[model samples]
Target: MEFSAADPGTVRPGGRTARVRAAVLRAAGDTLAERGFAHLDLADIARRAEVGRTTVYRRWGTVTGLVADLLADMAEQSLPRTETGSLLGDLKANARLVQRTLADPRQGALFKAVIAAATCESKTAAALHRFYDTRVKEWAPCVQQAVDRGEVPAGTDVHEVIRAVSAPLYYRLLTCGDGLDEAAADRAAEAAATAARAGVYVLG
Candidate 1:
């Protein structure tokens, strides 16, 4: 499970504005990973990004605003679903991707900070939900393809199956101190694939 160069809080797009956005977002993620969300300051972030503080404040009025943009950039930069041509393989790909992300120290810490911030802020919470929604949507087609191939029951909740694959891994990240490993990723993928095959995700 190799971590991506760009995580959910990191995005590198083309052009000047995109470049500034990526720099600022990267600095923001680094800050959050190091100091948590409570200590996030726009001026400090600007300094870290080597961008003008006025530019950051003018573009993003608040920390939450900047976080929202970071999340949008992350979704924009996230890798597309891998088509392994089979449900199990596709799910394993997805699981391994998630496992690597949570296993990375910086990404794991940044996500923890963002999730903690979301717990107390409505706007941040909404943005976090949207972020996960975008990721789930990106992978839902794999489940749909599985259905087309007669691997799962019709009317299976594609979103549920996808979420199921990541739920336990996240729980482990947040709770257990055990390192996120490839074996855990494989188990998650297998469990989700098994449940999907059993019609556990079928809508009533």
Candidate 2:
């Protein structure tokens, strides 16, 4: 069966299939982090996953397809939005989560590899965009709730505010010059909260 970008979730398998897919994804993530997308080989993935080469080829079709499905799975498994009753609290929670993920050796390397691939591959870029979009949408309601509570002005660009909370954390991760520590997360949360209160993200 051919998997489309529009229906990545539909590629789910049952029992053995599910286990194989999970193994392949884990192997793919490790390979991508270690060797990058250009060097990714289905044979290597099959060997690492302990699945048959033919099965990998038949299921994923191409590297892009596999990456897309892996990203879709990540989206499905991502943590739900934080609702802490205040914009500052919610943003801090979000930033802290990002900091923790980026600080992890395996996850940080995997993200860097995926981002590097997305820069040159259109398919990977699209998948990356979808992943961030899913994450942003999930957290945007916190900003909206703040508006409703009169903590921030109405007509705030909730999505933009949410994005602002993570932008600096991602910047640090991609640059590799600094650590995305809890202090940095706190600063990001403070900056985004300050900006929102100052009408930086408010829409006229």
Candidate 3:
């Protein structure tokens, strides 16, 4: 099922509609973090949010649609990328941000649940892709600035460089189960920076 950002629950409105959305989304996130996606039900979420069942059903439609909007809201509410002068500094900052999010108990569990859902659900997968796309675009400019400053090759793949900084951190989060700390974040940033300097991310 194709999902559009322009869908009912995806758009951010104000007043009562916004409050209802916020409460429902908070409830949805809590459900995902605590019980995983399989247990997510619109009626249950409505009860949790103290909103009307008809309201939740009318606004979000299906669980997939609700999840899609939840992902969208997360992308919208995520903190903006930081600019730290140099590529290493900026990459380190980005890495640390990712590390902190994955280290948080609730956020980590929510991500794990969403990722598990994405594996089997095409709409969830699409929403997850969109979430990453938004984040990558937010951080990609730092790599471009590095290129302008001659810190990396002129044709370095900016998005890939950004992705590189977070890939290892995520690997540890999902599989290694090691300490996903700031030191690990620094190492990931350093590795990506070294690769970018060596033109590993340069477009052919």
lDDT (tens digit, per residue) of candidate 3 on 101-138: 88777877888899999999999999999989998999
Stretches of candidate 3 exceeding 4 Å from the true structure: 1-14
Which residue ranges in model 1 land beyond 4 Å of their true spot? 1-13
Selected candidate, larger lDDT, 2 vs 3: 3
What shift in Å separates residue 203 of candidate 1 from its native position after superposition? 0.5
Give the Cα lDDT of each candidate: 0.86, 0.82, 0.86
Better of 2 and 3 by TM-score: 3
**Residue pairs in steric clash, candidate 3?**
none
Residue pairs that clash (backbone atoms under 3 angstroms), model 1? none
Per-residue CA lDDT of model 1 for 1-204, tens digit only, reads 222337533345478887777788889889999999999999999999999999999999999999888777777777788999999999999999988888889988888898999999988899888889889998999999999999999999999999999888888988984758989998999999999999999999
Give the Cα-based TM-score of candidate 2 against the true structure.
0.90
Q: List model 2 lDDT by residue over 161-180, tens digit each.
A: 98898889889988873777
Worst 10 residues of 1 by lDDT: 1-10
**TM-scores, each model vs. reference:** 0.94, 0.90, 0.93
RMSD values, in order shown: 2.3, 5.2, 4.5
Error of 3 at 135 (Å): 0.3
